[model samples]
Target: MRLLGFGLTGLVVLLALISLVLGPAAIGPAESLYALFTDTGTPLTLVMREIRLPRMVLALGIGASLGLSGAAMQGYLRNPLADPGLIGVSASAALGAVLAIQTGIAAHFAFGLPLCALAGAVVGVSLVMLLAGPRGSSLTLILAGIAISSLAAAFTSLVLNLSPNPFAANEIVFWMMGSLSDRSMSHVWLALPLMVVGWALLGSLGRSLDALTLGEDAAEAMGIGLRRVRWQVVLGTAAAVGAATAVAGAIGFVGLVVPHILRPLVGARPGALLWASALGGAAMLLASDVAVRVVLPSGDLKLGVVTALVGAPLFLHLIYRTRREMA
Candidate 1:
């Protein structure tokens, strides 16, 4: 337990240091650290404050939210493989933001996009839960999620196709690809408070999740309120995930992979796993974002694509190993 805690802490600290120091510029760690408090190099200071800080803040915010949300979802459903996007919640949120952008509503109302996305996520997940019934049908939930995701994707496409404005299609495509580049402080502010609220709500679900490991009937026998627990995770997830998708678009893989990777280190307890995943996720996405800056010099690489590159293999490996273990 001590070693696991140390390791997670070390990884998080090291990753944060790397994110704050390393960048596309030639500013070394010494200079960057120096300029952190003292404004030495005007250009480097500007880069750190105006550009990198906002991006880093966003990286931490969105990554942590996704990780915690995934852990919560897995706990709520007691499914190791369950994910928010996999459950159709993320797709619905994305569609909502896209629609807002298409109608030019977001231009006038800064918070409109995220608000719409939040509403869309609520609707999508509501439909999924309704379809799965009160029992939360595991297989049916997955199927319902898939069906809903497909429908949302189709509708988003149809909207783009029907729009007279040509920019809408391209913008929507790029938005879905997910980039953290050139995002303003406004985006950071928009997501941070909401994500904090989500974290608090979801973080409290740890004990409930631990109880849920015994199955709903057993848990209820132990005085656990399963319905309340379910809402805590679901609504909490939607808010955080919606806020994240609103700002950074749809960056995948963090939520799915972070908790699983850290579960052993954090112990098998879902609660411990949840907080650790948030920290680990902040590390992962920040590192990935930094890596994107280093790898491609021509243009800004989409954060989602980078995560997908790493996460797709992990997903495949999980499936293969699961098969082996079962076999």
Candidate 2:
């Protein structure tokens, strides 16, 4: 299964490479490789270097970030449905990005918006934890996440409403919807470090997550300290989701859907599934982003819209499956 996963992941990377090179003014693999490294002055080289590379990197980073974060959440909560978006983490990050754009913070510094989004994620996790409380059940955590998301969303709408500038308001509207067009390498560089750190933290949780399969009490008996695991999950998820949102806005569904799709292929083991999910997620997201470009040749397409179009139905399917299992 692991070998199959690695092979699948490699196939996805190949597809991403094809996507990167097969655009309207497409370049061959050799040319693309040369352009990617040599950084020549030809138009094809420039396009491959400047336009496609950044977008590909953004897709990979955002996908991996969402995928691992979701894996961590599912592992920690002992529920397949527990994802970063459901827990208000992504919403908080989006709210923060929106606030930054509307208030001229992003105008001051290019990286300001993503940084603020990261901050928002931190606050969101803090609030959700507070509301969930120590003895909270899985249901309690989900409810708290919903409550926190609603509150954060309201605050975001309120902030936008109170803004004096109409342009900023319109900008805020687009920012919330989420897209990857016109994103520079600066955005990629801005969020990648934190995402890397977050991935490391999440990946390490695999063994802990496997222990969690036996239930929290059993995990504790096996010396997996529950409190420590909880903090690690929260902090690790916040880092990944927040950083990705800071760069890509609120990209929904990738986190939730990736884990569900790959879990079975990895034999449903947390210890082995974490990195597999990350690679699968990167491939999945890059594929989706490539699809967006192919479908909308006229202009840029919304990243969230593409993911949601694919993700919404997948999420519904998961819910149905969960219900069936419970029944």
Best by lDDT: 2
- Candidate 1: stretches off by over 4 Å: 39-43, 107-112, 122-148
lDDT score, candidate 2, position 45: 73
Worst 10 residues of 2 by lDDT: 18-27
What are the clashing pairs of model 2? Answer: none
Every model's TM-score: 0.88, 0.90
Error of 1 at 41 (Å): 8.6
- Model 1's C-alpha root-mean-square deviation from the true structure amounts to 2.7
Taking all chains together, the TM-score of candidate 2 against the true structure is: 0.90
In model 1, what is the error at residue 150, expressed in angstroms?
3.7
